[model samples]
Structure formats: structure tokens, C-alpha cells
Target: MDRTRFFVRVAAVYALIGAFMGSHMAGGGGLELSAIHAHILVVGWLSMFAFAVYYKLFNIPKNSKLSVIHVWSSFIGVFGLTVGMWLYYTRPIEGMQTFNTIFFIVGGTILLIAFVVFAIMAFVHGKFISEE
Candidate 1:
């Protein structure tokens, strides 16, 4: 499913969001969103871009179910984690602390699982390959 392209595109979106947040903060926006901005840049942009490069340079089997899981979970985890963080920190609405916390934790857990799966894939199929 063109995982490399997919990951890179998603990562680009995260990069823009993170950049905007940084610019906002520089322009006198409070530091309230600083942590969220950092996480989005790191986990969302950097990690995803790295993963995309991995897919581009490695010989992970196209049919591997593990790759699918890792890719999707990475996307979901980033989205959930970033949105969850913003919600929890901003408290845009009332009485949603528990929801926000749960959402953040679940996203982190999913990202962890994706990392574990990536490690497993590296062990199982991270062979070098010629350009396709």
C-alpha cells in the first residue's frame, strides 16, 4: 500500500503543524502548547519520516502483516497522542479529564506496540536491497 509514501506524507503534515505551533509560540503565544508541539515534531514528524526511510531502504516483505500494523498504528498513535495532549492541556471543554488521559495513554501504548513490531520486523526481515 505504498507505506513509504504514506508515512512521508503524514510526516509532512505533522512537520507543518509543529512548525506553525513553534512560530505561534515565538510570536507571543504562551508556552502552554510547547510540550504538545515538541511531541508532534518528534514522534509525529521525525519518527514517521525515519520509518518511511526505513521502508524505502529495506527489504521488508510487501505482504507482511506486521508492516501494515506498524504503519497504521504509527499514524493512529501520532494523531491520538497529539490530539489527546492538546485536549488535556488546553481543557477546551469541561469534565473531560478522564477522557483526555485515557486517550493519551492509549495512544502512547499503541505507539509503543508499533515500535516493538518494528523491532520484530527488523529482526525478521530488515535485509538490505537494491533500488526497486
Candidate 2:
């Protein structure tokens, strides 16, 4: 239920995956998934971790409805975007490129909405703490 912790943990997982992919590529595993790997690290690891830091510093309540929504939506967005892109580029299903395009777009849109919601929450609950 700790939203900040949840986001951070998710980011950690993404970090591990990204590192693994980087290693694989360095080992000459081809550059086929380079874009997917980059997005996974940037959007999944960095972005989620940044969100965690924001929530922590902003003192957003873990039990807030907005927190729950942000957590789920962000996770879904990251997963959808990464997986969809991978599938699209890989063409594992032969005729699913259109589906993958839609999937990634929807995912990106969901992520955008989540960020907007987070911005609203931040502005509504944010207060400047003066260091004395």
C-alpha cells in the first residue's frame, strides 16, 4: 500500500531488466531490441523512480485514491508501451503490427493522463517547506 515504495520497486525491476538487456547487446546479441530496451530503462525505471521520489518528497498519502490510480495507470502504461513496441518490431504475430501500434499509443496516452493527474495532485497538495 505504500505507493512510493511500490513505484520504486517496480523501477528496480525495470532497472535489472534493462541492465540485462544491455549486457546481452554488448555480448553481440544484435541491436534488434535496442529501442525497447532504452524505453524500458528510461520510461519504466527512470520515470517510475522519479515519480516515487516526487511522491515521497511531496508527502502524498499512500492511501489516497489518486495515488492508487497513478500507480496502476503508470504500471499499465509502461508495460503496455514496452511490450507493445517489442511485439510490433519483432512481428511475432505476423499480422499484429496495427494492434501493437494501437496498444503502444493507448499506453502512451494512459501514461500522459497519469502524469496529468499527478500534476493536479501535486499542485493541490503541494506546499513549500521553508528551511530555517
Candidate 3:
């Protein structure tokens, strides 16, 4: 399948898993797990899936290597951020505080880069209509 569709599907799966885990954690009453679950559902699932749908609906060129790069980078970035949060919350480190901070910053930067690239590609595609 196309990259956009593929990513959307993957994001959906992540969302479902996040929901399940969140509910389970809530039922058992754990604050840390709940927070991690929220992060995964919101960032990893909802945001990523929304971006995928946006890219697909906008008809981003399949051959655009930049779009491909954006997709992969954003995916990895979000995945890392979510996973890192999960790790940090579940296994609180006593002195390795910098590790979690670095993970978040790196992931956020990667996602920001992906957004910039995606915007550039979309603008270059001339899909936007100007009422001059």
C-alpha cells in the first residue's frame, strides 16, 4: 500500500493499543501509566494518524522523496518520544535525568523538521488556491 495509508494504519494500531493500556492502567489506578498512555494516544496515535490522513487527502506526490523522508522521520520521532516517556514514567531513573530530556528534545526536533519539510512540499505542489 501507499506510504500514507501504511502510516495511517500503523498509527491506528498504536492508538488502539494505547487506549487498551490506558484503560487497563486506569482500572488498576496508576498515575504514571495513565500519563504514558495519554502521551501515546495523543502524540503517537492521534497526531501521527492525522498527519497521515492530511498527506494522503492532499494527494502528496508518491514519488516525492522528501515526503517519504518526512513520513519516516516523523514516525521515528513520535515513536521515540512516546517510548521514552513510557520508559521514564514506568522506570523512574534516580540520576539519569538528562537521558529523558535528551530523548524528548531530539524527538521534538525531528518532528518539527518533518513538519517544515511537509509544509514545503505541500506549498511546492501548488495545491493551495489563491484568490487574487
Please report the candidate that would top lDDT against the real structure.
Answer: 1
- Tell me model 2's lDDT, rounded to 2 decimals: 0.84
Model 3 misplaced stretches (Cα beyond 4 Å): 92-97, 128-132
User: Candidate 3, TM-score vs. the true structure?
Assistant: 0.78
Cα TM-score per model: 0.94, 0.88, 0.78
- TM-score of decoy 2: 0.88
Q: Candidate 1, residue 89: CA error in Å?
A: 1.0
Lowest-sum lDDT 10-residue window in model 1: 123-132
Please tell me which predicted candidate would have the highest TM-score against the true structure.
Answer: 1
TM-score of 1: 0.94
Worst 10 residues of 2 by lDDT: 123-132
Each candidate: RMSD: 2.0, 2.0, 3.2
Instruction: Kindly list the per-residue Cα lDDT of model 2 for residues 34-80, writing each as its tens digit.
Output: 99999999999999999888876766665678778888889998988
lDDT of 3 by residue, 1-132 (tens): 377677788789888989899788778887657767887887778877877777666766778788788888878877777767765665576776678777777877787787788777767876642333
* Residue-pair clash count for candidate 2: 0
